[model samples]
Target: MGIGSWFGFGDKSARASEPQPEPAHTVPTSQDLLDAVDRVEQQAKDGKAPGMVQSRLGRVARTVRDTVPRLDTLGSGSPQAYNVMATATNYLPDAIGGYLRLPRQWADSRPVDRGKTPLMILIDQLDLLGATMDKVFDAVCRADAEALVVHGRFLEEKFGAAAGGGDLIIGSTPVPPMPATDPSGPSPLTPPPGRTA
Candidate 1:
């Protein structure tokens, strides 16, 4: 006010020189993915989609729910990760919303795509999403399964045979071998010197 407002010279220059705040780069969380799934499910329910559509939608949602916690296994910025996010946040919702926008009777009866009606098309889309989600879930699980296999192999290599000639080996410790017994010797189960059974 003292210098810039009076002269009108410093105000514009100072404002231009100041750094602007960057837009927030929002990273979706697992809960966000679950909430998206919930929204899509509720939409399908409220929209009164056919039984088949509801079933397929449930399949995709279930798989996405299972996979959300393991998305890190798919790696950040990877295609699988992106697909999971996109399916939850956009593709699934868009497909349902598009169908829902149409009047129910026309959507169910009219064949907009060749011989298939909108209902059929929506079912197909849901099936595709379901399969894709299944694959993504499998990929996430497979990462942990592979790690387990690798660890088993490592243990086998490091510890040699776990049971070699009936001798057990646990980690680095070797189980003590059974004492040798003479065929003619007194029964090993006999009571010791001072006691009799």
Candidate 2:
């Protein structure tokens, strides 16, 4: 055997045969995403994030909550779905956590990048996440809305009438029309001889 082999470094086949490590980043489950969001909220509250920061965090959290249920609609392979997962599990928590790690007075008051404080940077990140989540939510909901429209069109075509404008039918019976009103009579709405209403 070669010197390298003696040192356990020369056999490519052996290296290939060894078990590999799991991926560093696996897709999170829905519950995992929600737990992350809850952690972020608790951190924000405990860390005393500013009102502005809290507001932004709340927006991102709400959007994440709204989007999680519709992840399937976004398709497991879609980037939008990935964004939802990452925003909850990584982007949002990281942004808030990083800011919380800093001295509050300094993080809020001192500029760290291009004249922006850590607070400002966190806000920007939160805003971006919020907007992305909003878009994903809209995209998911749009699919259902479009289906409703398409179904309505199909229904209209099958019934041969506008949705609410034609004679009503239930199973095999047509609903009767209301009797005509007499033009010369006192209005039906006028109480018999106005006793106090």
Candidate 3:
């Protein structure tokens, strides 16, 4: 709808004339991510990492640290292995950093405040990272290099959207089905005949 549009120039043309803002998060290379993990690990141990962030970073760091010995099993030549490693080290911890950057008032109130806040957004980012970690771990266990690579791309999609300032929702949890309990004394240890265990 700008004057450029009437002249047949697309938004891209108009955008090219404007200075772009620096990105909030820098996409990390493998080495950069590894170094960050090391720093974050030390930070966590030093008790300087913020409360919620500490555990998440520690978990990702530990998972990747344990996987280091088995990188060969995943294959050094496997891009997915590297992708998984980088994403875990990079994006996961970055969310923690994002939370730390928020003002204490905003960060503290976010937990009780009934609105979208920076802390809430960072939490959503962490949730995405945790899910990504699950996929990476599963792929590594299965020695599925391809899946790891794809998972890296998936992380980029989710994290990229967040970095791009898109809405991220943690949404409600769905209740899982539970088995009915019997008041009668212990049922047979084994399922009755003709029933699947």
Candidate 4:
């Protein structure tokens, strides 16, 4: 074995024996893609929170639907494109679920979000997912192999293995809790005193 081969970088025979992880590539069919998109749409409708969250989710859903056609487009139909789309889809449902879990009072208050409301944060996350879908769509539309590679690297850096499952922890920022409240009562969007315009 050469010096390179000595450090677990063995001969072809040894390398071949080692099990490799399946590539993140996904060869999703049109039906599969469409079905996944439908699920995301339903999730958007069902899980949408009140106020800004609803609007953001609506935009994200529309963007996802728009990106679906790119799957059947000439260049963007590659497995890599599907991989990115799939990852984005995976994140959507979980994100909506996270929003549903947070009380409106906490999610709406700006101080809890460090000057940004939870709705703003949620919108940013949806925007990121939509942007990725747009990139994948554009790459496919143009059949630009180089752009495909660039998109792939961005996914790799941004998500690592998480993109495969589309489960990035976007709501990691803490939202302050409200005072005691009735579970059935509506949570009010109240700005702290003296801060009100």
Q: Which candidate has the top score in TM-score?
A: 2
**Candidate 3, position 128, lDDT:** 65
lDDT minimum window of 10 residues, candidate 1: 1-10
**lDDT for each of the candidates?**
0.89, 0.87, 0.64, 0.64
Candidate 2 local lDDT, 85-141, one digit each (tens): 888887888898899999999998999899999999998988888888888899989
Any idea what lDDT model 4 has?
A: 0.64
Clash tally for model 1: 0
| lDDT of candidate 3 over 1-197, digit per residue (tens) | 58877775768767677788987975445565567678766754563545665666666676665555555676666765765666556565566665666675767566544577666666566666666666666777777567687887899887663253443455675454455668685576867778887
Deviation of model 3 at 145, angstroms: 13
Model 3 residue runs over 4 Å out of place are: 1-35, 44-50, 76-79, 110-114, 144-197
Could you tell which candidate, 3 or 4, scores higher by lDDT?
A: 4
Ranking by lDDT: 1, 2, 4, 3
Which is superior by TM-score, 1 or 3?
A: 1
- Candidate that would win on lDDT: 1
- TM-scores for the candidates: 0.72, 0.73, 0.45, 0.46
Cα deviation at 152, candidate 2, in Å, is 2.5
After aligning candidate 1 to the native by TM-score, how far in Å is the CA of 183 from where it should be? 32
Q: In every candidate, how many clashes are there?
A: 0, 0, 0, 1
Clashes of 3: 0
